[model samples]
Target: MQISDLPYTDPGVPDARSGPRFLWWLGRNQAGGQLKSLAWGLLHFGGVMALPYGVGFAVQAVVDRSGGRLAFAGLLLVLAGVCLAFGDTMLHRTAVTNWITAAARVQQLLARRTAHLGSALTRRVAAGEVVAVSTGDVEKIGWFVEAVSRFTAAAVTVAAVCVALLIHQPDLGLVVALGVPLVALGVLPLLPRATRLADVQREKAGKATELASDTVAGLRVLRGIGGEELFLDRYRRASQDVRHAAVRSARMWSAISALQVLLPGALLIVVVWHGLGLVRDGRIEVGELVTVYSAVMLLTYPLRHFEEIAMAYSFSRPSAKRAARVLSLERTTTGGPDAGPVADPAGGADDPRTPPSGDLFDPVTGLLAPEGRLTAVVCGDPDEAGRLAERLGGHAALDEGDVPGPSVRLGEAPLDALPLDAARAVVLVQDKDPVLLSGTLSELLDVPASGNVTVDDALTAAECGDVLDALAQASVDEDPMAAPITERGRSLSGGQRQRLALARSLVTDPEVLVLDEPTSAVDSHTEARIADGLRTVRKGRTTVVCTSSPLLLDRAERVVFVHEGEVAAVGVHRVLVRTDPRYRAVVTRETEEEQRRSGSTANSTDAASPNGSGPVIEIEETA
Candidate 1:
């Protein structure tokens, strides 16, 4: 499709078998645009090749002393000039259109693939590599796509020009014809080395970008732990490696550029020197000598396209390979012992479109939450809790090595077997890390929902009134929802961020909502209020909370104690705490920590404003 028709209804399934195959798929999809570009390129290069012929005819007309012929030749030159102007402008126009549309298509495909893979993408592919694909790699791929048409036209023009010379003057034509091929093909030997150097440069640059990204993301933590200098030193070393690799790649490309110029100049000299001898021997006229010299000189312009095409391929091959590699990551369909074989295309499914509604079951862990119940899972390790939470949402740790058991199913329908979007509509997962995107508070909370829970209801359920007060105190508008959240909600305290994220999640009100340590950042009183609010708001809907907090666990109808990665006890929270020693140890440790944190909070509150009405501004440091 053309650039104007962009944002395709479907970018279509990419043939990501290899780098070349992916590129070929892109070209095939944009065949119409490529053909149009080729036509314009032919028009432009044809006029250029005709210019020297027009000039030569004018010179011959002058020697014959024919006024009419001279005027006619001048008219031909004017026509060629007009053609050159129109054709050149349109060729460039079409080329850019091809480039933009191709890049847009690639971007769409990458975005779709990322969505399908979910958290698994960063696990399998480097974050910096994904960033590079979206930014630099897409541009390189588009450049190669746009260059193909122009390169074809230039190659054809060079061949046609040689054929014309061979017919007009065989003696000098033989040398010119053979020399043109030599000039174009001479750089072939240097290409393999150049491409290898470019690949090395790309790899080193990706590592440096990843390192810099990590350092920035954890800058606050590094400074707090007195480890900023350590990471900075590591990053500096990575940057130096990238710089060295870039220099090596640049040197190889520079050598290739030199060869292109050197070989073309040599060909020009040979054709000119030979043509001059033909004129001296009376084998050809003076005008014919000038014509031969002008043809060789003008041919250099199109000849440069050879080197450009080579360079474009060198950069884009790796880019296409990377894009293909990311696009090929399939969402694991086999979530349980009975999960059927599935397509390799990420998120693709041949299953029945209808999603079933019933109890949520994970066969691997033998955990079952009957439909319309709030179930609490007590896991000692936060890492294990996070993985369990993700699995409940159909995001198993397949990339990290399959942990045997867990294809979460809703009744008879397997969640992972469903299309990714369909699976998400069934279950929503919120991890301990609450990443609030930068935006107005209203916008941040605006997400796809079942509409069963309103914004006010969710905010109340999350016990975020203090968060609202914090926003209102900091805002010029005095409207808490209108207040802006800076990147990652860095403007808010840890507690405030957690509460706001809970509000956002509550707004969705999915069929099965899985929360991992949702209230860990908040104080005991707030956690108790949140636990009560959650039970009220989520009444008669399936919910799973992976937490050890007694406040939240006490609200649950049932608690499942998981030890050594398997179900250890299943009963009411109070009964398990009293009867199950292993379960009690995990719960007791968390209870002790919460009590200590509560004591610290009471001491801090005692020293606050005398009226106790003053807002307690808690940054992450204070929290």
Candidate 2:
């Protein structure tokens, strides 16, 4: 099956049955292969039992003094050795296949779920948890799945050996068989405690992984603030906690292992002692006594597997439950009839397919970026604006009962109705500090869909011409377009990274490009060039710039001022600056004290100088 076809819809309120159901689903998906593996396991385990029987016969024959049959017993012993070797080889081969296939299935499921959830997945789950699930948890799940058939065969084989021994010497066989089970049962009470400890270890490990990821992602900023050592200290503490938990978990398993070895050894001793008595009393023939003793000894192999299977299960069960939890995350619903097959948009603009809706209306803030216009969203509180943006992009669900306005709609279509790919294609929401992936300048600018827009043209529009020149001046052999950017564009200045990200978004040429403070990082000259360039590039298409930048606002056809996350004012940038007190207080930030207010920064004078006729406004501070 294609990776895209994996089920991503949550099955709802997972219980004990969830893990088994998922495994059963996997089994059904690979029914033929699983059956073949199971058959091989059974054959191998059966062969394992046959060897001990053959050895017993050989021993009995030596004791019987049957001179002519002595060579026959020797030949049987040789054949038994061959069977044991063959059984071991086949068992390992089948088990490995089961492991690899099970891991592949889980990987496919995770990939599908990640795509289905998109950005929401990170918001809902820790980044490290996702990484751990894909890596460590997947392997543990495979271990349990592959262990299932071998465990079953081993159990059955052990039972059969016990029965055979009972037939040969009822009293001794019964004691050995009964005592082995009692010792195995002793582990059950400790199982819950062991699993709990294992869970704690896994949780701490996940947290440590998350801290490491966070530290790496923010390494540049941490260094800039001289806080690298602080974060490093915190990460070390987290790692130690994980180590402590791991040691605790290992102690439990060590105890379990001790029991596993001790119980089987004791059982062997009991069987040997009782069998010697029977032989001395002449209650059984030497050959029969040998057979009984061999059977009991053979049982040891399967008994060891029993312990191994138990331990494998205890470790894997928690991992499977974690994977199941990830799989259970519901795909965000867009509450409309599925968009049926449409002609590929790649065919041409005139193809029967209509461009998807691009309007974004938010009920909470009563904000609307009407179709086909340059709109500005001015939020006094940047955090509130961020929440609105998430909801607008359909990355989050709104509590409609608590809000009292129309939902965000793309054209006439609800944002959720459009498939994730189609929605993303139509409306690109650029963050205030959009991440620049590690790549060459050309590659960074070449986002998913640029249509006929060339990389050079996108860079010029975002006013990154100078940035490219700087890269070239550094005597770098790499083409500016080919230069390798560090993660999050740490290699470049903040303003340069912001512009590059803008150029990338501009290249995509989506129907509605929602940019959050696109020029917040750039200086006046570049900001002016970007404002003018955006207007020229986005002429007829709908573009929403969520910023308090007066230069960008001046270029916008409509400026919306948001106060306490509500549309407190809306008008031309010039008109709002002159008339609206809330708008004036936010945009002008005229006083020195106002600039120092929490979360507010000195507004840049870039736009006023460009047009040469507007009042000055301060820029917003970035997190």
Candidate 3:
């Protein structure tokens, strides 16, 4: 494909049968670019082989005192220089294009798989391994793909040059041809050991990356529990292992590099010594001797491609294997690689049996959220609440030891039976701690919307006026809406970040919005404003919020209290609080302490914690 057609609309189904096959699949898809690179490489190396012949002819002409022949040699040298300049430029251009396109294809595929699998992708693969495949592994895969065409051209050039030499001067040609092949193939036997060392280095490096990612993701919790030094020491040890492995791999490659130099230098010495003998005995002209010497030097250049291609393959093979493994993963509900939605005998105009939109029902918990209403789910176990939220979003069976739950259904159609994108479009599950990707405010808020909520409205609904003000303050030179956010929104307070994340979810305006502890970080005052705004904006839309906050539950149209992993009761928030002692205990574990600290008439918006959310929420969750 041309460069303009990038970010491919469809990267096509990958041939993920094996690593070698996956690599071959990539090559076949980009045949046009590969062919272009190979053609240019041949032209470039063909010119490189001509320079020696021109120099030798010029030398002969000079010794014979032939002005016409020397002029012809000069003309040939000029032609060779032109070819070298143009061919080399185009060769590199095509090679780089090939590399970039291959990487882009893999990135697109990974992104698609990531979106489809959701959190389940991480369940099957290590976070560090995924990170490596996307970053360094991607570059290595591209490196090998780009190296193949150049290696082919180099091989052709070597063969062509050897044949020409044999016809022109058999004496020096035989030794030159034999020595060059030996130099290129001699390192083949050392490759298996070097590759093994490199693989070890890669494994250790991946583990270290995974450790760093985990530490960063939970740094707050680690600090709270005073486990920072414990994790830090573990990371240090992992990093040290990576360093040791890298050194071992580097040493082997260094030996290979040394051999590359030594073998070529030794071959050059033998050629020079033989040429000198031929010249002294008057068997060949001085000009022929010069031609032989320079040709031997030129052959050294193309021979290096053999070593480079080998090293490229060695690194890239593992990367391709890892990529293939990730791509091969399917959601258990997805059945297998070729599975699709099961067709219903009672069909409608639509192809799949998936319903357009309706109530979300979880049979395992007997929780039913009616269409065009807001429902609040209260469970004493925060972990259980999180898992139920995951199931509602069509991601099932993530945690172990939990009873197998029935598939959540939208109308009569099971959510798991629907396509991932279709399900995501209908149900938006915002976890308690949602991630805020680094971008401008506008970019962050630019999500698929139902045209029902504007950015201003969403921010207002989520009580994010202070969030906008903070962003504006940070980016004084730019528009407030265009202000840039730091990675994970770490620059903002936890409460402020939570409010912004709430605004983002509101912007999506999906058919079924599932929010887990959407306002746990916000103060009681802001939380009340958010509850009011959320109710007003989502007046007729189905919204499921998994939270124990009284303000939010008080605002919900209906409250479904789950007890012992089953729906124990369903009614208004006040009714549940008054009638259900279990639900009251779950929602009001620290209400007396919080009220005493903040005073009853102050709207429950405690001023003790600057970030809106205080230690009370955490204490209740743990209790």
TM-score of each: 0.83, 0.83, 0.73
Residue lDDT tens for model 2, 30-50: 555556556666666666667
Candidate 1 lDDT over residue span 342-423, tens digit each? 3232232454444456899887666788789999998867788877777787754343233335467788777777657767
Off by over 4 Å in 3: 1-11, 58-71, 111-131, 211-240, 272-289, 329-355, 362-388, 395-407, 416-421, 438-485, 507-509, 517-541, 545-623
| Candidate achieving the largest lDDT | 3
Ranking by lDDT: 3, 1, 2
Q: What's the lDDT for candidate 1?
A: 0.83
**Ten-residue region with minimum lDDT total, candidate 3:** 614-623
lDDT for model 2, please. Answer: 0.72
Give per-model CA RMSD. Answer: 10.0, 7.1, 9.1
Once fitted onto the true fold, the runs of candidate 2 whose alpha carbons sit more than 4 angstroms away are 1-24, 338-352, 357-359, 380-383, 395-407, 432-435, 450-452, 473-478, 486-490, 523-525, 548-551, 562-566, 574-623
Clashes of 2: 5
lDDT of 2 at 526: 80
Q: How accurate locally, in lDDT, is each candidate?
A: 0.83, 0.72, 0.84
Q: Which pairs clash in model 3?
A: 523-612
- Per-model clash counts, in order, read 2, 5, 1
TM-score, candidate number 2: 0.83
Model 1 backbone overlap count: 2
